[model samples]
Target: MSRVILVFYGSYRQDRQGIKLARWIVEALAARGDRAELVDAKAVDLPMLDRRHSDYREGEAPAAMAALADRIAAADGFVFVAGEYNGGLQPGLKNLVDHYLPQFAWRPAAVASYSAGPFAGIRAATAWRTTLGAMGMVVTSTPLSLARIGGAFDTAGLPAGEDGGRLIKAFPRFADDLCWWIDAAKAQRAAERPPF
Candidate 1:
């Protein structure tokens, strides 16, 4: 079976909660026959968009951004693990999404957000939905939010609370949805190709 590539859209720094969540998810997806890869926004060298060449059709996106677009184009699905910033979406994630709009169309997307607040980063998830929806991606409803993320991860690099169990349970459903959509889209694309 071909594996679905999961994209972790967050900072790569070791101490970051979003990164931790991304790691856990990638591990879980790997266990489920999916080839997961984290698109660490921090490590990616995406320069600010130069106004003159930002459009996909006519503009030259930065090398890093172009590489990211290529990755998205190849992936079967996407899992966005994001961190909330002042009750909104993270700028780094926004930049990454902004740079790769054309390539993300019709892809299946799942979002995970982490924060130390009560809302559990749902606000960030909503913002992410709007952004991904604008790009024509199908957003999954099996969303996961890690509240008080600092206390959730153990010394062994695993989620140590109920949140971890919740994430584990949610993933299979998300994976199911992703596979369904991906296969359907692939079939549709294949049918649309004219035989020569």
Candidate 2:
């Protein structure tokens, strides 16, 4: 069955490389016949979290965030694209994720992280796994990490040379695992009461 997957990228600057990578992943998913949608955190333009308990209890999310909440709620799975900054995820991405808690419950999440350095944003992926788990998401274990991102992709945003070869080979497995989780999670959600 076709799955609705949200490809969420955490980048606010126009020159950011993560955005390009996010687009590539979305295209790849679409090519595989999945219904993929891109959610650029910068475009969402959510403010920092500073809401009162009454506001949260009343479901009074900021106007800009309401639509995002709806999209996240509708998605069967998620792909989180992030870049490492100060050994963690970008603040904008973190803030956007913090805006909604229940929407992520019991969903599956996969992480793809890129960096200019040799580590390939592994630290950021690790951080995402932790945070996503805490939010009640079943994060995939096989995360996609691209190091020296400047040299990783060509003009078409496809991986180049050896990097391309490796990613091309690995992507199918990753996608398969993620889709399995999505199907299993959706079935579980349908059969049982929500944990939240």
Candidate 3:
């Protein structure tokens, strides 16, 4: 079955490169017949998590947080596009993850990390793998890492030349692995009906 995937990016700058990559990935997934939507961290406008469980018990969460949680809960899988900051995951993305907990359970996630430098944001992807895994997400092992991302795309925001070819080649395996896990997880969730 076709999957509904959320391609979420963590970049809050006025001129963000991660957005471009996020759009590209979303389009690619769509072309492959997946229903993919791009979710910008800035657009979500989630505040830092400061409320206690008692606060949550009192009433509904903030509108933005509730909407984000709804989208995440509805998605069959995820593609988290992370940009490196100081050789680590961006704080905005970390905050987004921290704000919602149960939305990610029993879901599969694939990470695509990018950097303006030569390192390809591998460290950020590594950190995300650990964090998402701990949150009960089945994170795919084959992550897409883009190095010198500033030049990796063309004016149309599509990957260019070698980078484009490489990503196109690798995407099938990544998507396959992610979809496999998503399907398996969904089946298990249906059969076991474990509370997430």
Candidate 4:
């Protein structure tokens, strides 16, 4: 069965490069028979963290926040396309995620971090592990770290050259790992209730 996966990209920059990677991820997931959607943080345009969805009355929350809460709860898995900034998580993504917690609980999440420099945003991806865990997602072990992301993915969201070739080869392992965990989580959730 095709899983409902959300590929989240959070970048507020004027000329965003990480979005290319996010688009590639969504296409790749779709090619693999997953119903993937790119949840662009810039497009969502949520305000800074304040009252979460659960904190608001049934219909009082912002339209975007309320709609995203429903989508998050329905998704079987999530993938974060993170961009490094000062060796830390992107503020846009951090803010978007902070808007809700329970909506993410019990799902599996994977991180694919990238940057224009050589570090590939590994630092930010590593930092996200604790945050993701705290938000109640089972983090995937396989990670996609892309360095000099502009060279790896073209503007059309396709892998470009040699670096792209290597990334394409590595993607299967990363995707399969997430799928495995998603299957396990789906089976478990169907079998019994989560003890919370």
lDDT per residue as tens, model 4, 1-196: 8999999999999989998899999999999999999999999999999888889999999999999999999999999999999989999999999999999999999999998988889999999988999999999999888889878876667898876887798899999999999999999899987846
Superposed by TM-score, candidate 2 places the C-alpha of residue 126 at a distance from the truth, in angstroms, of: 0.6
> Candidate 4: which stretches are off by over 4 Å?
none
lDDT of 3 at 178: 82
Backbone clashes for every candidate come to: 0, 0, 0, 0
Leading candidate by lDDT: 4
Q: What is the C-alpha lDDT of each candidate?
A: 0.74, 0.85, 0.84, 0.92
State every prediction's TM-score relative to the real structure. Answer: 0.86, 0.92, 0.93, 0.97
**Comparing 1 and 4 by TM-score, which wins?**
4
Name the regions of candidate 3 deviating beyond 4 angstroms.
52-55, 193-196
Q: Candidate 1 or 2, higher TM-score?
A: 2
Model 1: per-residue Cα lDDT at residue 94: 77
TM-score of 4: 0.97
Lowest summed lDDT over 10 consecutive residues: which window, candidate 4? Answer: 154-163
Error (Å) of candidate 2 at residue 176 is: 0.8
Better of 2 and 4 by lDDT: 4
2 versus 3: better TM-score goes to:
3
Candidate 1 stretches greater than 4 Å from native: 12-14, 51-61, 193-196
